[model samples]
Target: MQKTERLVAITVLLQARGKMTAQRLSNILGVSTRTIYRDIITLSLAHVPVSMEYGPGGGYYLPDDYHLESAIFTREEAISLILSADISGNHNLFAGDTDLHHALVKLEAVLPEEYRIDVMAAREHILVDTSAWCNKTQEPTHLETIRAAVLNSYQLDVLFSDTSCCQVHPGAGMLWRRIEPHGLVFKGLSRRHARVGRWYLVAFCQRCRSFHTLRVSDIEQVYVHEETITPRPNFDLHDYWREARKQLEKLKPPIIFKLHVKAVARYSTLHGDVTILKEEPDGSAIVQVNAESMDDAISYALGLGADATVLDPPHVRMAVAQTAQAITKIYS
Candidate 1:
């Protein structure tokens, strides 16, 4: 590769990897260790914060918050980026990032007149709207506050919504809880839940003292502690999420109930991973699904209109009957 490209590559490498030894950088870049050292000097000369550690265990590193506004993208990459950004919920995914809009505007402004047409043409033909129907998409409150707590590692005092509070006394206030902010998990099209592009706060609850996952929509108010917090030992985001789901299963045992579905087409409303156990000759299916709770299971059965029937978990059947009676009484 060219020296200029190599320099850009080195900057990107350090930016991504956070730190790398000269030997390791050389191996990755297919250059001599001497060349790596020279490149480091070049980066430092260019005002990149390239720091070195003496002795063993450390080599070259950048500051924890070092970020360069500059980036290089190819013609196709630039077009793809524009198209993708256009569909990112009108730049709402970034929460409070005005820079995202600024960067996009700058990128478009600098593109050649001919290249601008290409981007606009692609967007005209291809629509990428991913909003859920029925206005079920939740507008989470206090996202900026919650996000800041996550970044600064501050404890959050959250007024989280609870089912008991909602049902028992509608006028009652929300429950107060303290969560040690870990990070925010934003859902995209990749996740199967009906509610797409929702934010989830994954943190360690002071009450539970373990890990907790609460939907940001469910959190009414968030009060952040200015004092920064130290994260727990061996806290891996992916691992914690995986284990949290497992714990959720124990607390609210998975309802492995069968459903009789008459829909000839696959129902998009059926959220999350589901297993199709059997298919009848008549375009109907008897499938097994996992719901978080009995109430959810009943809702699933009811949502199918007459097309679905819950075959197991007799309590769900009873609940369905009671709900139907209540509805009938209201309409009667």
Candidate 2:
């Protein structure tokens, strides 16, 4: 590894642990012990708090309060960091507000003149129109506290808002919930919409004895306990999510209905998953969809606007007619 890379690697290693021997650093960095010593001195000169111990099993250590400064990142690294920070929802994972901001400033300072202009231009011109359903912002501190509790295998007293009701409630709402913090999953598409881009903590809920989806937004507060819980044996998060998706899909009845839609092109393109049974030359399309009930199917057809005409089971057409009558009554 290059001297610069080795320096960064050493810093990472020290942060993960408190100390590393010269031999271990050499082996990890694929360099000679002498080179490692040289790099350590260089880092020390750069204000990296590096300490050396001398003994039979001596090694190098960084002080508990040691931190990397802004000079560590090159211009390219700085730009990447800024872009990442702009999109990162959990900014609190990094220590200190000033640390992240200072890093961003350093990155901007070193950005290539042309690249900086291009980035500014892209930001100015790009317009992202998100849908109304978007996820809410989660407080970084709350998420971190919950994560720490999960990591330490401790139970948490959480103040949570139940989605079933629109009010916030406080207490040790869910108790003695042993959780093995598996991971966090980002769900939804858009960040701007209230229900879009929400984050969920995916953990094994000991109280329910099942996997529970807790929205980050619903978590009002988290209090960590001293207890720990053992993780499920051979728990595969990937398979768990796959099965979860399937179960959710099964809950929604299949869309099955027949529609003679006038805007054939528009309807087919939008509801292509619903089989197109036939088509007419006058720009009309005959489509069939399998749904759990007539009400559900008709409601879906209505969403297609005036372009759609239901030609299915008699009961479904009658339901649609009744809906139209109800609308006419209100208007008239």
Candidate 3:
């Protein structure tokens, strides 16, 4: 690569990979260690925060706060970036990052007129909404407070939504639980899906003496504390979420329901959690499904009309029968 490209590459590598030795940079850029050192000096002359450490784990690194002033992107890359910014729930994901907003505006201003038109056309064809259907999306009231506490390694005094009524009773500190904020988990989808994005505060609850995934919206009140606490040893957000989901599945096992399906065409409407046990000669099928409760099973059966019947689980079948009879009486 040319010297100018090599210099830019070095800057990007340091910024992306955090730290690298001269030998590693030389090996990556197919250049000599001397050339790598010269490139580092050139970047330093350009006011890049390139620093080095001398020790067993020493390497060349940019400061933690160092950021590139500007970036160059190809046509495809620019389109991808602009579309990502456009469809990121209109700044909902970033939680009102003014820097990001300004950066995007700058990027748009620099794009050529032709490229700008192409990007706008692409946006018109493709739209992504990350919210759940039926208006189930929840916005946390104490998101900023929890976010600050997590960033500063501070404890949070939280009142969970476990009371008898909708209002908090203004109880003593006995009711407020203290937690060491570990991280925040935003669970949501990108496509047109049913699962809406919900913010969850993962923390070590001192009262329970265990890790808890507290829903942000359900937190009635939160107070950030001056007392900072270190995170748990080797705490990983993705690993904790995976293990927590496994335990949750164990706690709430799927309720199986056996069903006799009549109209095969309507079978496509069934939920994804289904298993066909047997198929009859009359195009009927016996299937098993998982529901949360008997009421869910009844509703599922009723939705199919005469196309399906809840066979096993006597109570669900009885409930479906009673509901059908009541509906028939109303029609008569």
Candidate 4:
């Protein structure tokens, strides 16, 4: 478990149970008593409202009237969160350092008496299961290590596969990269119905002298060096990600397609843009839409079926005609 997660757990435990001895906290968190002592000290330093008591049965606890500013989730909000945590395939957000069941136990303990019932009712009532039907969720294995390296500002040695497309195959040539990792992106699976995620590491590549994004799963090895790093000047992680997405978009020139549709012209614009240029005498709409490629444009037009006709672009018209002929042949 991460130190940050452990501190949060300790704070929740102390606030919920009134007081717990360091030894007990150690037992609960699976750490040494000495580590608990250190955490208590750290919490105190961070102004977490934690205090230690000295006596036979004494331990560390928060003052009754005292609570951290962050401990302000309302009963409804808390229940919603607990409900979300209970669902399988939820992000490790609620389950970090401990399972949701245990975390909810501590959470309910801290809640006011009136809220406890709501929490319990929510636990029994609502269920959200996000696990894919066809495939199990695959958690990225190297995300933690890479995130740690980024947070600690350590130089990282990465041995990654030449291509992410066939990452499982052994024969993909190895590429050694040294980077000062800045951010991690939990991108959705590029493949259809894939439950697994593809984690991308955004880092300053020393060799390339520019920021680079690489798949974490494709990375065959990771070596975090102790030496501190100098982060690039004026490089914002969010900005970089946005710019990278734009670059990817520019790879294929978008198409502007002209169409005449009998109806559902509005729906054609959902994925891109559709502007009504004119309305035909026969109650049809003449419109223009943008698509990433000719295939996308053709597919969108096809989806409109006989209701839509390609008005311009001779090449697209030819392709659609050929496709229509093929369909007609199959039917005939």
Candidate 5:
């Protein structure tokens, strides 16, 4: 690794546990003890607060509260950071002080003059069409609390709003669920179709008497429970979600539909699924998939908008028409 990269790595290692010997750092960085000392001085010159101790327990340490004020990046590194931030920004995932905009500002401030222009040019031209789905107001804080509980392997007593019914009773509506959070899954598509962009916290709900997928937004309040639920030894998050998706699919009646999608080269490159049935001579492709019910299939087609068309199962076309009429009645 380059000296600058090594410096960043060293800082991260020291910060992780707050202390490390020069010899240990030297071994980890594949440099000599003398090189480690020189790098420490270099870091200090760059305004990093590093302290050194002597004797048997001697080592280098950053104060517990020290924070990284700046970072060094190559042009490529800068672009990657900006693009990642841009993508996340599109998702409405960064609405607060901790968002991508802040990170970009810091990066631009510290970036070398030679690479600044390229970074700015890339930022100016790169565009991400995030889904229109907006995050729930309390999502960030709620996610953090749930994450902490999950990491600590603690049970959660959560007040949840069940959305299965059309109208909810005001006073007696709240349900308390004891959940053992397993993992988080960002399911469905973009934010615009937010009902589709459901962020689920997969958990074993004791009250439900089975595993459940709880929407993050549906959680009203959470209290960390005193008990910790032990996860099964063979539990794997990836396998769990795969099974969940399949089970969900099974619950819906199978509706076969075909779509002729006018695949935009640029857009397709980013979001297209090649695993679907067919690709045409032109850039356009035919897609074949099964939805739970006719209504579900029609909704999926509508989400694709004019870019796709229903080419099979003539009944699906009627179903789509009826759904459109029903939706239009609301506005009418």
Candidate 6:
């Protein structure tokens, strides 16, 4: 029996039978007393509210008010439901954050042994976050249609409006294009420092004869084809995205600068624009500011006022100092 299954079984038994001793639970579940004790600890961590009574009638029992609506699920069914909830999270159409999270926990606590390891591994690799920068929901228009097309392996006739495309096709606003929807990804430039992101469709463009990552937001219209298409062979979304980001980084690398910011301003300094490298005893931090250019970097540091100072890239520091002196002259 897997740990999760055993934990769920223990929970059910305690809730139904009431006041089960460790030895009894161990014998019933075909596990050791030591294992039962550990399982009890795990249940507590998952917030099951299991309590123990001491002395002659000593045994573990759940509070009278605590109740779990139990359902028997096949191994595959449980795994799928758990992983789906894990990936989608409380964002998107599934907006019940608290309820869905707890439901996932309960479902995961009952997965059978054969499917447990694989499910856990899959969870680590797949994540779908639909949150925008300021804790706001940033869902794209026509996201539902695009998502359905990707899942069903359908071709799409899309009206795309890209500012960059305007140079090539002057006066052309929204271009009509056909594509085979390969996958959907929600990501930003630097995965580590990316707090803000938009949904992008990784599709094989029929006109371009190449795979293009099109911003879903920029897609003005979407028409799903009646006929479904087979998925492209040997196509891996993760691998494709990795190579695409590499090429993009080569074209324009991030402009990085060092900053020494007071703790009070640290929250404002971060704001998804910087990554902290170290923290000091005086409640200050050394952070690396990432931007598109030196001007952008200088502007960010200056915005922090006296709470932040540029430490490296002497030229940048000089520029920031000059800007500050000019501002001081205006006030004086």
TM-score: which candidate is best? 1
Tens-digit per-residue lDDT, 34-138, candidate 1: 788898888887787889997867878878787643444456766766665577644354546554445456657667777788888898899965655554555
Question: Using alpha carbons, what is the TM-score of model 1?
Answer: 0.63
Among the numbered candidates, top lDDT falls to 6
* lDDT computed for candidate 2: 0.59
**By summed lDDT, which 10 consecutive residues of candidate 5 come out lowest?**
265-274
What tens digits encode model 3's per-residue C-alpha lDDT throughout 1-332? 56765675676667667778875676455565678889888888888889999887789998888765534345666677667666664435345544444555666666788778888899889887655555655567888788767755788888885431213344333256788987777765222254445687888877657677777888888888899876464666667888876865687565677888885643466664578899888878899988655666667788777788888888778888998899899999
Model 5 C-alpha lDDT per residue in residues 189-275, reported as the tens digit of each score: 322233345567878867545677777878889999868776564565667788987876666546767777787732443232223
Give the poorly placed runs of model 2, Cα more than 4 Å off.
Answer: 1-109, 133-201, 207-233, 264-279, 287-300, 312-332
Model 2 TM-score is: 0.47
The number of residue pairs in model 3 that clash at the backbone is 0
lDDT of 6 at 86: 60
Pull out the clashing pairs in model 5: 131-191, 131-192, 132-191, 132-192, 133-191, 133-192, 253-292
Q: How many residue pairs clash (N, CA or C atoms closer than 3 angstroms) in each of the candidate models, in the order given?
A: 0, 15, 0, 0, 7, 0
Q: What lDDT does each candidate get?
A: 0.67, 0.59, 0.70, 0.68, 0.66, 0.72
Q: Tens digit of lDDT per residue, candidate 6, span 191-232?
A: 222344667788887765678778788999999997775546
Using lDDT as the yardstick, the better of models 2 and 5 is: 5
Query: Comparing candidate 3 with candidate 5, which one achieves the higher TM-score?
Result: 3
lDDT of 1 at 212: 68
Error of 5 at 328 (Å): 7.2
Q: Which pairs of residues collide in candidate 6?
A: none
